[model samples]
Target chain A: MANVPKLSDPQSELLDKVDVFIFDCDGVIWRGDSLIDGIAETLERLRKAGKKMFFVTNNSTKSRAGYKKKFDGLGLTDVPAEEIFSSSFAAAAYLEQSNFPTDGSKKVYVIGEVGIGEELDLIGIPHLGGPADNDKVANMGSGGRLEVDPDVGAVIVGFDRDVNYYKIQYAQLCINEGDAEFIATNLDAVTHLTDAQEWAGNGSMVGAIRGCTGQEPTVVGKPSPLMIEYLESKYGMDRSRICMVGDRLDTDVLFGTDNGLKSLLVLSGVTSEEKLLSPDNSITPDFYADDINAFFASETATV
Target chain B: MANVPKLSDPQSELLDKVDVFIFDCDGVIWRGDSLIDGIAETLERLRKAGKKMFFVTNNSTKSRAGYKKKFDGLGLTDVPAEEIFSSSFAAAAYLEQSNFPTDGSKKVYVIGEVGIGEELDLIGIPHLGGPADNDKVANMGSGGRLEVDPDVGAVIVGFDRDVNYYKIQYAQLCINEGDAEFIATNLDAVTHLTDAQEWAGNGSMVGAIRGCTGQEPTVVGKPSPLMIEYLESKYGMDRSRICMVGDRLDTDVLFGTDNGLKSLLVLSGVTSEEKLLSPDNSITPDFYADDINAFFASETATV
Candidate 1:
């Protein structure tokens, strides 16, 4: 609840204490298919300064391997697949953590794309009800009824391009049984892709199931503390030494501030400094800068 | 929000004043393919008493012609297609009321089945977007981006069995254009067909677009005054002489009470007298019966 500090120049004095740096991918490091100016160089310098790096994203449409390819496609070198944590992978990890039946007996009725399917496959979890044969179910009975898969013990939803009434019907029936676990990748309403306009995000699919079933999902994406929790458990990183940087205050900044981590807002993506300082927004960052490059430029001046 | 009256047996005095009887089909007339016993005879007697008959339903998946076919399949006699006021048809009527361009220059982007498409076609209203190419759009780009048709001036949603991300994405963009009218058939959360479990209704699809775009739709189904407005304007129905008969409270009964029309609740399908009279529920009907047969049994006594 502290007043947002003016981030004219970030000091290495603050960076020297940071052991882990979590970067939001889409708006922080890159915009559309291009990287922000001087961001790659800034990451390189941060790496040389012994700062551990992790890329966290709420985009559940891609798997970790796919994210790695996206990183490689953008010429972001030295980032292995393990260093990337996507919401789709976070959902897989959440199910695995909850011991979703891996005995080959129970399966997760997935309502997402291949990204969610791949993550579940990597974690040795069985799944059914994917994006395959969407039209077959679409043209079914008047009520859009489908036979129940008795083996479905969980219902997981992400960014499903093939979201149909059949999937919502089946998922509602499964979750309404009162035993299946419901998990959502994120609740991001709109995703900003180019500069044209905003598009509906994964939450539309997640919310469709929620609206039908009236059941709350355990969200596993940004600002949920699941990604940071995964990083802590996997790498044993101290929360106090972690610094979060991103363009959105709701997801990236809120994720850091809510967890006692230093959060910075960059103006390269969705939100702006004027909007953040506006009376309508309650979420505020500890610091603000033009972009990651601008934030890093201040670090060089301090050095 | 008045307290629900305890209705044991309806008075024939109320029936004597009734001229137009609006019945909800799914639960009141029949429960999925079988007519309630003696209901056809009751309709015959009512028609003999000079009462006009109309069927109003929130089931948007079927066109009025399709509803007539369904009525014939159930062996219900003497019902015409013009007397059927379905949500799909109502949506068409609503657009026609608004003077939506019929010049073929303006189009309605539909995110529903052929039922909705057929109604628009019958009215000679130009429209695009049907369930035929659902999968083609489903397998399009990863982000499910479709070029916004410049001619689209309205977006209509009903019970779309083929509700995909592309439909929602395109619909959201069209509605976000600030000039396109957003219309939903009904916002029923779940469609109860066989009573085994809950299946998602049009509300699931409508709510998805609402959640994504933060826009409210002009609902045209039960509980909305648009249906009553349509009947009043088209058939010149007198509200005082109209009686709405249905099994559900929130939709069928509320629609009647909201407009000062006498409401009757039957217990054959969804809402029970126990639930209606419960302190938790606010929607109430002026009369209650075991089923349509029971109501007709009382009518015989009056005769």
Candidate 2:
């Protein structure tokens, strides 16, 4: 058998060429509520080394302002708001630039809370369902009234607390009857939190509609070209020089691998060693590290 | 607008009689960590009313034993292990019965964990990726230097944490190179936890591979006729009398709609109101309730 190169034993030479370090929060920096070991020191050390580092988190729960507060609380004050990228921001920016057909009367049915809803408003997209909207609806099989907005033009799938069967059914009817385009904030199926385990991300919601309508959605989050394009436009870095680091392989590593960038998988969060060794792996990281501190200390100077 | 018939509205009196009550676990009974209010009491009430209720969660994370423990913890002690139906069990039973082209020497690349993996082992399917097997090497990725089992017959997709790009690429290669049939445990896009959000279910993982290989998978989960058939065979109930209850409209409600059964959507979980009103709505539930308890208490009982 030929000696095929495994990522675990990276030729040591490929490790030195990274220029931009894209860090995924939640898993790499902090799992849920607490910071990973030596993550703050790792960021400071990387900043001192003059590496162009940015925080790329797919979590849409918090806005950039919230992230800034989280970073400051975690002792990562060097990075500014502009250096942080979130799916919420990317979704908003993509909507702004996207040439999808929209009518002044057309409504964007949003399923998210303040952050995602606010982003749609900021982009001048008209939305239908929200806290104040009287013409509210819910999915079928959920035991809610199906209030169909006949004038709806698009369905934007986001995270929400009050989702129901009536809501899903109404969304389906719109797609089937209105021929509306669909967009999801992200394809992440689950979000990892501080205290609890993982929950469904936009992908789950997207899957439901897609399965029913047989239409794929235009995703605008991590690993999606939209988020990456937004980041590249702002950061002015070649895609090849950027590396995506996180604890889970599907989102972070898959994002990096899909975009032809290096992925570094850390063992400090959601994914375990048993998963890494499974035969059904769909995402493979370019590099594997114990923690961000070790990755920064060992690979920073080399890169 | 002429009174639009609200299929999900309990007050609409769409369902006058109850036949079979199918339940999904994640959001309807409980969101992530705890049970939704009034679920046990409602189930008990419905049980006392002599309704045929079956707990049918699509989550492949746990087995019958695991779900039994969870249901017992919730104090719904009326159900037995035989009542639960998981995707893994469905896949295992299907593979066991359908004379799938396994020559005993044919290698099987298992993409999921214990739920799916253990089932394959129990069915005498030769696994290729474990430590003990070298003759038929199984890995997450399809492209590799290892001895590609010449007798490889099928590529399986399951809920795997170790999934990576290489694994998908490898699976694609195996299918293209060896002409192996592609099979998936389920097409769930997200799995829910109580407190956290959703995680990428097997659907997205399969999508990544399908994007490359241009091959669709043979799915074995809810909404798949195989599962419905298996249930019908085991339970001996008329398919028309079954009512599927879940949080998301895409899977649970759609399953019912597609199979000519009644579907109920619960607000205690993933599907949201905005989604139902969106132009893209597809899967409309037959009925809706704030939660399972409300279904029985409200007009859902007679309607």
Candidate 3:
């Protein structure tokens, strides 16, 4: 029994020790479309207390700008686009920082949604595939090769509702035959489709490509130091004063601890309390709470 | 260096020691639609010598009858439909032997091609989702649950060029939530699209479902003894008199050795001599040949 502190009061000493708060959107702020109980008010309170807040999500289906619209739709209008860091944006940022091919001689072959394309477009990187290739099917019956675009220098894979055999085969060909670099936006296994259901995530799509190519992709999501390193270099934030809050033990909590920051686990999303307290569980969070609502719970309430 | 005997003479002692010859189709007999030179004549001679033969292919894209068509097309008209054993047919055979839900109570859900569906139809097993679900897309934007057919008792995944996210997600839902059994036809990493090209196989599609469900499937392909055990019981063959021949070291040679049978490697397809003789390679074949044609080459020619 690890004695993990429960942050049940607004004036908890752990809250005063942190100057910056990083939150995961799906489970912490909202599950699917609906907002979490008092998460909006909790953010406003934290903002009033002079704490800087940023939302980091592994969902690559949306860019940072797209995530801003989602926040607004959930009535969290105060959350700005600049404070959001999505895996889609991280992939583009990673490529831009690494000096990826900028010339028209080579382009990225995307096996994902439009958000990845939009992010690449913002960075002025030429790319093809994505939603456009969703309906495409390979002519396997013809006993001919699927034409590999010689200009493809990289294959960026992310979450896609329209993932098909064409994209999987094309990505495999690009990486195995075209000698293209493989990049994955995230590797989260299952994602919340709604408050009660879980669906296959981008990791499943990436696994298919990995199976055939027999190569591992450079993952750019949580638990990977890519995004956090970008945030540190861009904002110059002190790692010791930053606290990460999320519902997943593998991605959210591991991301914070692996980067030498504090993490808080919430029981509102995918992970249940029983799973966290299980004897075999090794990922220990700095703090645990019923939900983000517990952060502002009255001191007179249950300890 | 380990001594792996090279078979060059038709009167090699190894040939007389074996009564049954199980061959892999793509690389041993042919590469794509083009049959290897003298392979048809070699089979005819082997039959004349009273050696029983069977074509065992991990290619689940076609059923036994479909493979017979390919054999006839390649001028191997003496090869009967019963002699062809495809992974698709093996999947159905595996389920039938296990006495899978024979009544109308539950059905198998297929995440593969028409071949798998056809094989299931042959065994009088009701199934859905194969080529029929190829064009289906998940309504991910709505954040609604993808309907899981409660009638699905098992999910049989094989090679499918029409594999899409809908099938992956649907299979995941059925296996994880609906408690359906997971069955994989084969786990071969790649398959020949043409002699010059290779594409992602059913293993990659199976990998996607395994990724989300976190479950291992009962693989019914090469290297697994399920098909070999079925053959042994059905035909009452002696294991000591069986020889497995193929081009791959992982599936073909491993399959034979794992099942206590002599294995022969042919260099007409994927594995090259360098790879086979590599110091780090652990899978050693009982015999190696340049191609099937080398089996009948004159002893005085080179060896």
C-alpha RMSD of each candidate structure in angstroms = 3.6, 16.9, 3.0
For residue A35, what is the lDDT in candidate 2? Answer: 79
Put down candidate 2 lDDT per residue, B192-285, tens digits, no spaces: 3213323345665565446445567888777687767776787787877678888877778888888888777777787666665456776677
| Docking quality class, candidate 3 | medium
Docking class of 1: acceptable
Output the lDDT of residue A246, model 3. 91
DockQ of each: 0.38, 0.03, 0.57
Instruction: Determine which window of 10 residues in candidate 2 chain B has minimal summed lDDT.
Output: B131-140
User: What would the per-residue lDDT of candidate 2 be over residues A12-101, giving only the tens digit for each residue?
Assistant: 534457777888887788865677878877777667766677788766656676678888887778779767777666666776666543
**Model 1, span A182-268: residue lDDT tens:** 988888878764345677877688778877777789999988987778778878888988989888887788899999888888888
Root mean square deviation (Cα) for candidate 2: 16.9
Clashing pairs in 3: none
The true-versus-predicted C-alpha distance at residue A298 of model 3, in Å, is 4.6
Error of 1 at A4 (Å): 5.6
Worst 10 residues of 3 chain A by lDDT: A1-10
What tens-digit string does per-residue lDDT give for candidate 3 at A157-186? 898878887888889888988889999998
For model 1, the DockQ equals 0.38
Q: Please give, for residues B1-303, the per-residue lDDT of candidate 1 as tens digits.
A: 436554445445456778888999888888877788888888887788788988988888789999999989888848999889999999999999889988887889898888899999998888877686576553243353457788898999888766777788788788876478899998888876545556788878887887787778998887889878887897788899999988888778888899999988888888866787788888778877788766456547777
Fnat computed for model 1: 0.47
Off by over 4 Å in 3: A8-12, A103-105, A139-143, A270-282, A293-303, B8-12, B139-143, B270-282, B293-303
